[model samples]
Target: MSAGLLRNSFKGAASAAPFFPTLLDQIPNAIVIFEADSQQLVYVNPAAESALDLSRKSLEGHNFHDLFGDNLQLGEMIHEVKSGQAPAQRQELLLHSLPGSIHQETIPAHVVIALMDDSDLMLMEWFPIDQQLRTERDERVTQQVEANKELMRNLAHEIKNPLGGIRGAAQLLEFELPEKGLREYTQVIIKESDRLQTLVDRLLAPHRKAHVMEYFNVHEALERVRSLVLAEFPKGLKIVRNYDTSLPDILGDREQLIQAVLNIAHNAAQALSVEIEAGVAQIELRTRVARSVTIAKQRYKLALDLDVIDNGPGIPADIRERIFFPLVSGREGGSGLGLTLAQTFVQQHQGSIACDSKPGCTHFHIQIPYRRQEKSE
Candidate 1:
């Protein structure tokens, strides 16, 4: 063979040598490749199959349009790429599968498409956004649930025993005291009991109650918490805002949302106390729109993302996962219910909450769906 022809033959073999299999196995993103001429799928990675919740054998030879359906941005992008146009836009699509023998269930999948080409084949990579999000959400929820159970058990033993003793002692003192001062001492006991009861109630609320969903603007709720934090910390802390103006009103109970955001923000503020004393405590409330997020195996059309970020001594790595449990505090006198309650409230909204912490910074990310429709005026 001529040298030039030999070189061309080697290059062609390299192009067809299951290049995608290696890429798909290594990269986290789900990827699919298609033939430019026929628009048929030639390759799918394990991540792609798992994300789509399908088998590789089933997806092979299927056209991109047939797999994703009609009137979708992803389909259009594929067409453009096939027609030799380099499109520079990312398209998000909601994929629903037809009921079939496999699992005999319908699945909602979220995919993002990007077009690339290698040799003569068009590479159409479909990323399963929903699956990734859902997996993370479920893990967090499971961890929180287990932590709350342990917390309730411990708190019941630690708190209720002392509370009972305090109440009994106060009753005895009231009986022995003079009539005028009796009411005053009795009132103190009653008030203290009531406060303790309230705390206990808050701790148990997640286990006893059902989640209620309502419509409210997330930004408004965050703003309320921001103002409250600022008022409390006045001169020491700075509360910064980074909001996505286009985010729609979220579907959640207003009060629950406020408490959830406030709980996380309060923790951030407390972490910044050393910085606050030095006149540089900084906390931020940020909001954004997220696509293709799944919670509890269900995919949402759009989700609200609220991040509470702070610059301080970050959460200790040893207890990072345990922080959401009631009474698992990082501070000397801290009650750990702040994060537990926050998780419960967000979970009630059919949403998810996660935390990532390291030295000098900590961030809590909350994801919930937006209201389906606006109320008419």
Candidate 2:
């Protein structure tokens, strides 16, 4: 909100108290108002309650420092603003939580503190930096993935016709060859053409299939992938299921969801070659209901957070950023279409996939909103 707007809203402080609280609650960023002299929190917005993982009833009447712990930088900024050395103060700082709080981890936030006009209250607004960055990255990745899919679809179609003609000509020529030895050249061309045709078909597979939406347990899909991956690496790799059984059944294509998770798990299994040989490779299929998540610039009240975590060497840096791009692979002789197709399937379900990797740890996080189909439709 603009400073002038806030000033006008607080013109008659006593009469506007109720309305002001409702107005502040509507803001997306976390906001807290403190008594200047007492330094005790008097108002906490809904966003603040969610971000802090604490109820406003419990947060109010508590000293700011007692709740968020001591941060010298933030204190300095607040001091400057309160002392009139600055009209307002803004800084990016780590927002710490006290022990025994619901969430004890420090939050990276961009904070702004300002003194309310002609009042003994200081208003503070903060945006969670990590969450903001994740949302932005998800948006950018989704856009890039859509662009890549379109380009690949067009390219695949363009190559498909020529590929068929090449294979047809090779077969026709092979039948008329006078010498059996010369048949090898035609046979090589035919085989290569067939291979390219197969590649093109796989590239267009997701688009060609009709979306079959149905309500099903996400764990069922995970179980399918677990079985498939374990069957392939039964001896060395271990697949662990960490699921929240209370999660409601989500609506989507069961096969597509299964394939997406399978691709991720399969890639993880392949990357754990060394760990598998040592009998320590592990992959975890974890699921939880994410609250108030934003996917591709749209916020959802609840979404599925499906994570595929692997205890193996992380993805190589060279191909990590473009892992979802078709034809980009880190492993030798790899088709590189696994992740691309997986991303496509998830995107079709109005979701996004994110990957984080470092040595000995890799996480593939997939989020899809839960929306029940209209009964009237």
Candidate 3:
């Protein structure tokens, strides 16, 4: 129906009643209507059902305070709107579901509350705060990735010329050594120089490779990593595959994607050394389809959600935030470039990777859009 007609219906004209429920269901935001007299919910949209993580039948008879907990601010605002002290209002609230609810938790939301004209009913619409936070976090990660790329490229190039000179001089010195035993000193210099060169090469690797995009199954990449890791840790660790067979093929560099996941899974296995020895280490590769996701400031109708989970001692709290930064490592003798390179590869595909760690579980979540570039526009 037209905008004017919808507003008229909200103002107590009964003509819009029959189809308005459908309209509410179509809205992306969570919305619900409440009977003012009893403070009981009368209607709920699908989005509301999903956001509240409950069914309509379970939520419809619950009182406003019950669903929203005993939040004083929310209760006061609803009272003001229902009593006609305010025509409409909005507030950012930490809403909590009742203790008896299936999932009792605090929900951060920007909520709008208003009274229905000439009707003993109230309407509420809310945008989940966590969604906004995720978008903001994605933007920050994108910015950080760009900054890191520029820094690594410049630093690697600056060290490249001197590195070659150091190796060249060491080779000349090896020939001039008076005694054969003295040659060991020059050999040490040469070996160390080669090691440094390898490190620099890795630092510049992301830029050197061409981004060869193609359509491929993501499970192909995961399976490759799973095989490699299992081959390395054959005896103790178990690799579990939780695949959504219905997932569509994604467009990207399949090799780069494999390397990205391999880096993550390899690190997880390494961290599980103690568990591996005890024969209790586990790694899970889970995939699912995510809808209506915003990644790095762009919204995608569909995206690939992949998780790499390990049951190992979590990342050290001190270095968890800096795990993606170059040269920062939690393990002794670790090069610390794995996660950095993994993040770079994912970012190249217009995707983001994140980690959440605790004492027993460390989860690496990666998301990449499923739509092709041309269709993304």
lDDT of each: 0.70, 0.84, 0.83
Candidate 1: tens digits of C-alpha lDDT, residues 103-143: 23334444444445353455555554565776876687676
Instruction: State every prediction's TM-score relative to the real structure.
Output: 0.60, 0.77, 0.76
TM-score of candidate 1 relative to the true fold: 0.60
Clashing residue pair totals per candidate (backbone < 3 A) = 0, 0, 0
Query: What is residue 287's positional error in candidate 2, in angstroms?
Result: 1.3
Indicate whether candidate 1 or candidate 3 has the larger lDDT: 3
- Stretches off by above 4 angstroms in model 3 are 1-91, 94-106, 113-124, 130-134, 137-141, 373-377
Worst 10 residues of 1 by lDDT: 1-10
Among these predictions, the greatest TM-score belongs to 2
lDDT (10s digit) by residue, model 2, range 248-304: 999999999999999999999999999999999999998876656567777776788
* Pairs of residues clashing in candidate 2: none
- Runs in model 1 lying further than 4 Å from the true structure: 1-121, 124-147, 150-169, 177-195, 205-213, 371-377
TM-score of 2: 0.77
Report lDDT (Cα) of residue 337, candidate 3: 89
lDDT of 2 at 159: 100
